[model samples]
Target: MGLWDDLKMQYRMGGITQRLIFWNIGVFLVSLIFYEFRLGTFIFPDWLALSSDPLVLAIHPWTLLTYAFLHSGFLHLLFNMLVLNYAGMLFLTFFKEKQLVGLYILSAIFSGIIFCGAYFLMGRVSIIVGASAAIMAILVAATTYSPHMPIRLLLIGRVQLWHMTAVILIIDLMQLMIENTGGHISHLAGAFFGFTYIKLLQTGTDLSKIVTGTVDGVLRMFKPSQPKPFKKVHRNYNTQPRSTTASKTAVKDKKQQQIDEILDKISRSGYDSLTQQEKDFLFNAGK
Candidate 1:
């Protein structure tokens, strides 16, 4: 296969996070191509910026959603995509695919709103573009969901996921006070959404449901309908009863039943009530 075809195949087979990164990279490259050829610029213009201009922002409101797919430079795209891949995989472990897509789009839009709000207040008039805000949202979500989850640093030993998230937030806060204040503000918005999303989920209110429905609707349009076929049954003239593997199976079943009872007790009285051996078992099982 050709290089382009291979890339397409890889992208199609990639997970949600990878697919998003591919889309952002593809858009960024297209923008670069246009810029290099001196053709019509693919970058969104300032007039399309979501600022105080109510009419413009209303008519082209889709830009708020699309802007996250556009990136300025290679380094910018690389960092954002890397974070997205890591966080997105973690997010899928607990969330449904539809919820993941919904959260991503919502995070992107909220990030744009914060970006424009900051620009307007700070007297900066420039079009905002990039997936950094959305990526930050995913990062916050993953770290918050698994705060004690260990992650290895290059030179340093392992640290809790929450620590990494805190460092990122601190840096972004400091940056907001210095350069690219609007961008940092956008990061804050994404972080807020991520944090709040987890909180709300704990309380049983999931905002991702709306996005899930929309995605399901779109997918249903392309699905083909198939009729059920009749099944045929044959009678056996001579049948023998199968004997149960009692000896070996009984031992395994007893172990599983004991584990289930322990889990049920923990659910009833909380993990603190679990004995040291039970705690060790749980930890090792998780690993």
Candidate 2:
């Protein structure tokens, strides 16, 4: 297949991680068209970037999440996308794709709020843009869930997940007071949110649901209403006998029972435990 065709295929088949990366890269490219390259840096407008001033944020509230999709430079976009791909994939292995998306969005907003609050308290004004906060949240959330999971690194061999997470957190901590303090603060805020997310999840509280539910509600509000298909009522003189209808009902009940058994098995031991015959049956039933 051609390059564009291949990318479309991948997008159709791949999970949320791939889609998120696509969105970040797509935004970066679109931003380039309007970006003014001054002093070898891409300067985004205040409407797009998250500003520390409460008034600016109040006026441009969307920046809390929009800023996460933006980057100040090519290298900034490249590194964040790389980390997002890695961390998002790891997160998916343990959680649903919806949860991963919800976490990414919620974390970015949480971090942005913290960034603004910190800056406001210090009586300083600044603007920030990048997906580092969201990406860091994904990485740390995955690490929190499976800290003992082994990961192999080039030249460094296999290490536990927490080890990798700690290194990143330590680096952020070390840089907290030095350069780019606001960015580092946002990163740490995202990390904190990630850690909290996993903990609350363990206690049977899914924080991601808030974001997921809000988005779903908003979509429902804006989605066009579909007209119901008109059905004409007809009296059939040649109706099936009662015995035949009862037999069909029995057969349908039997099929539903089998489906329930397969679903229960999947919930207990996962879909991989199902036999090929059972898999085919389920797939056909779904269709």
Candidate 3:
């Protein structure tokens, strides 16, 4: 397969985390059209990027979550996606993809609100855009859930999950008074939200349900209603060979059984547990 076909196959086999990464990258590419070369920054419209002004936010509140899909630069997008992929996969190991999706969206809004509030208090007007906030939430959430989880790092040997999270948080804290203060504030806000999410989840209260429910509700609104089925009527199938029909049914059942087995393996041991052959089979089945 060509590169595009290869990527499409990969996307089909991968889970929600891979889809999320693709979305961020897709958004970044589209956003390049609005880049202001002269200013060395993207000049997104007020409705797109989160503004510190309360009035602006009131006019376009959706920017809170929308901003998280945007990035300031190529490196900014790259760094966030790398961390997101790592943390998101770790998160999926323990939580459902639905919860991860909700956490990402909710945390971005929480972080954006905090960032806007901070800037408003400082009497500064500015716009912020990046997935760092949501990415931080995923990373911190995973770490909170599995602080003792061992991770192997290049040239650093194995380290506890919390060690990595602490270093990142410390860097953000130290940079609070330095440059990109708004970005740092948002990152910290997202981290706090992540930690809080895990705590509430442990208490048997899942906050992610709110976002997921809202999303489902909105989707239902746009969903095309299915047509009611007519009354069943018996039809002669002797026109086609009985053996051909039986053979097709057997093939279909076999394919479905294989699919079910692969899915069960994924559920029990995570997607990474699948062998290359199984991955290829799943991808081809999807096609």
Give each model a TM-score: 0.70, 0.79, 0.86
In the range 213-267, model 3's lDDT, one tens digit per residue, is: 9989999999999999999989766888889999999999999999999988876
Sequence-dependent TM-score of model 2: 0.79
Model 3, global lDDT? 0.90
Tens-digit per-residue lDDT, 1-287, candidate 2:
34564466445445688789889889989888777788877898888889999999999999999999999998888888888988987898899998998899999999999999999999999999999999899899999889999999889999999998999999999999999999999999999999999999999999899988998999999999999999999888867899999999999999999999988886566555767678667766765
Ranking by TM-score: 3, 2, 1
User: What does each candidate score in C-alpha RMSD?
Assistant: 10.9, 6.9, 3.3
Best by lDDT: 3
Model 1, 1-287: lDDT tens digits are 34564455446435576678788887777666444322433444533333434455667888788778776566667878888878887787778766677788999898887776766676666566777788788778877788898888789889998998999999998888778766788888999999888889889998888788777888999888788988989887744433345665787788678778777875466445766677555444434
How would the candidate models be sorted by lDDT, starting from the highest?
3, 2, 1
Poorest stretch of ten by lDDT in candidate 2: 5-14
User: Better model by lDDT, 1 or 3?
Assistant: 3
